[model samples]
Target: MRFTLSSSILLAILLAILAWPVAGCGPTPSAPQAAAIPLESFSGRVLTTGLEAPWELSFGPDDMLWVTEREGRRITRIDPATGEMTEAITIDEVLVDQQHQGLLGMAFDPLLLQGDDRNYVYVAYTYDATPDDGDEQDDPRAKVVRLTYSESAETLGEPVELISGVPAGSDHNGGRLKIGPDELLYYSLGEQGANQFNRYCAPIEAQRLPTLAEVEAEDWSAYKGKILRMELDGSIPADNPELGGVQSHIFSYGHRNPQGLVFGPDGALYAVEHGPNTDDEVNLIEAGGNYGWPHIAGYRDDQAYVYANWSAAPDCEQLTWTGLTDPAGIPKSVPVQTESAWEQDFVEPLKTLFTVHNSYDFEDETCGASYFICRPSVAPSSVDVYPHDGPIPGWGGSLLATTLKNGAVYRFKLSGDARGIRDVDKLFDTVNRYRDLAIGPDDRTFYIATDTSGLTRDTEGGATDQLANPGSILVFTFTGGRVKSASR
Candidate 1:
């Protein structure tokens, strides 16, 4: 049946047809709008590849890039311009155990290459501990050694043990070394990953301090989860604060796993540490200060974190780990302490990467079994400060932090005094675990080192094992002028 329509009715129908939404023509319903990328213009290139689990990257006084291979147990030097590689040294004494345990953290002496006869390179690594007379086997131990670099042979030798027998385990070694403005060596040690996961029955001693007799006997059992300040000869600094009336190598205490340590231009020490499930922290480290761990996460607001002392549980070995709080199968014998319940005074973090409420949803169907990678924490690995005269505009006096889970560098703009973080912006996001980064001599180029393999969030925000650049150093050069955001 056909019917003739009036002119006015026909015009109205045409207008309605034009106003109807079309598929893929506009924003999708219930989908979030993606924000614009921040960088003006940049280009990336592979500076050097084929590294075996590169852990640290630093530019030496010779203008050559020095890297530590965690699993390879070797130190390599690379020419940044030509990408030529050279093996400086290979320590056969180093032990490599799955992912987190191996050679880690390298620092150069300030007098290196100055012909001052002090061309030293400090390295921290795990080693096999000698079993006692009756014990089956001893836990793994870590040591810090000083090696002299030969100018003529271009090799490292003459190993001098600075400190040894520190608490080390299969996980949470921390292992970050830095030379402070006072010309002292600063090393960060983790809590050995106790009271969680496989080691849930082990006690956490981050708050423990050594006795005066222990220091005299060289007992570093209380050194776990601490920042150590020492002389080049391995003696404790004279001016170090005496905590609990006992002086030792400990500079600060109560750290979980502080993997990133750097001295800012203002002479203040900064540390970046990983939290349990949330509240990754950027801290302004102070001598003798305690950054609460296991008791407080991020702030004392009692948000999403609670310190569950599984080691104190009566039947800890019998309970299954659900990796959640207040789950059904967990017994009430386990002591769970909130942030407010702790009465100790501790320093709060300068910045928390991402903090959420206790009710925040943690499950993500897209992440599948590796759902923890989809959590808010980015697993901060390393940090560096950009100078005020950096080549990139609006990036001066900023803190550049590297992440493992998110595979990105988070640029945090610092306040004038450098004590506060004004704001943060994510940059150089790729599907690779960013282990460390170093600024080039020109300040226009940035060299980022990535792990050989790891789980990282893909572009679609799902957990994936694919990496764009593995075991390689990527160079990101800033190009002036406005253009579309470029990231690999």
Candidate 2:
């Protein structure tokens, strides 16, 4: 549950290396390397429908799945046994903003089965209205609120402010929350204007500069673009790493917008991050480590923000990521050029290529294709680590993740007993297509939250509905005693 700072940084570096290409090659293989294997998936009946912008899922005290609808402003409960769903509670009394403000994340009190008979679901969401300065999105209180549910897992008690005062932006409110193996609630919050650097994905304005005094004396205590860890009761833990005489509640900083947080079977906290245009990242969160966000995406370091004046040595291979730059400006995009400048300078100015085989202009006419991969129809948004104390029937151990675009939940079985799963794409299978998923105590069934983007799987249908969903929860029942054979 805890790791030293050194291990965290090392893992970050390892993630960077895995994310980018290394040497010059014609193009990387279109498929994952030989060692990588496909993962298996089983389909189940769809449980509930008519959910509006559903976000996260967790198990309640009564063996029902709890879901949050970002736009519906409702907490829903689904019976895992029957796959039937009902709106347990609706927040018609509380102010609801149809925009980014709504229920975003949900977490259950582990003690629900223990001391208190009360069923409680903690949530992070945006409140109605903003500060006069248009900075209300950055206000912490407006970002996260905790509500208690009745014993039947329906209705609500008066809302309690567990921890408030987190900064919100018009968007990029990294409000995903989860209680880690350490029994601490770890959540993410992103900074405003964090999207500008990825020129290809969204319209980006020029970067801003914080005055030197603002940079040093600024109060980072308030959450914004940080991964914060606290007790289930919402108090910052004491053992968190310290920075500058302050016990940084920030387990790690420099994240753009991390939507996924799941502890791997190995007990490591793993995160799935959406990058500007080309990069979508899966990171291992380590205590006291800086994820190098607003400063780095994937393995590429941002030279503009100098950390401690550590001038990254140019010739130093480890300093910057040159192998891959998320094809800036493209969403649901795949890499066109597999060759790195470090290997073939002749292939500079890589031109964009479309799925239809049309080519964007590139100066390098001599270039040849080596890798012809497409962007995944589903962009990974949230992840759930496998082999929990609950029932995860036929499947032995796996990592479950969800995609925003595809509305499919994927379960990845790790190979080798390492802290990381190398070349995961190789293990990808056709059935691995469900959104955020959680295993039931019955083990045979796992619940999934569907994005309901209504996009066709062929033309990248699930891309834009990252937040826009008439979302719903469903249960997947495994018929065979074991997972289906993994496909190639």
The reply for model 1, stretches above 4 Å from the true place, is 1-40, 131-137, 324-329, 482-488
**Local distance difference test, each candidate:** 0.82, 0.50
- The candidate maximizing TM-score is 1
lDDT of 2 by residue, 1-488 (tens): 11112444334323322232221121223223222211223343556677776777877767778788777778777776665777867765323442335677777767765667645667887664434565433342344456666654457666777665455555666678887767788887665433232212322211122233432453333455678887766665889776434664567766667777877656677777665433456676777666554344344322111111112233232333322223442222222322121121111101100111112232222222311122322356687765645344423455666755333444454445634443332111112223467767666666777654433122222123233223656555554433223233
Worst 10 residues of 1 by lDDT: 21-30
- Residue-level lDDT of model 1, residues 72-99, one tens digit each, is 8999999998889999999988878657
Candidate 2, residue 7: Cα displacement in angstroms equals 48
C-alpha positional error of residue 129 in candidate 2 after TM-score superposition, expressed in Å: 5.6
Clashing pairs in 1: none
Q: What TM-score, computed on C-alpha atoms, does each candidate reach?
A: 0.89, 0.66
Q: How many residue pairs in model 1 have overlapping backbones?
A: 0
**Candidate 2 segments whose C-alpha is farther than 4 A from its true place:** 1-41, 92-100, 115-119, 129-141, 192-222, 300-378, 388-395, 415-418, 422-435, 452-456, 459-470, 481-488
Cα displacement (angstroms), candidate 1, residue 141, comes to 0.8
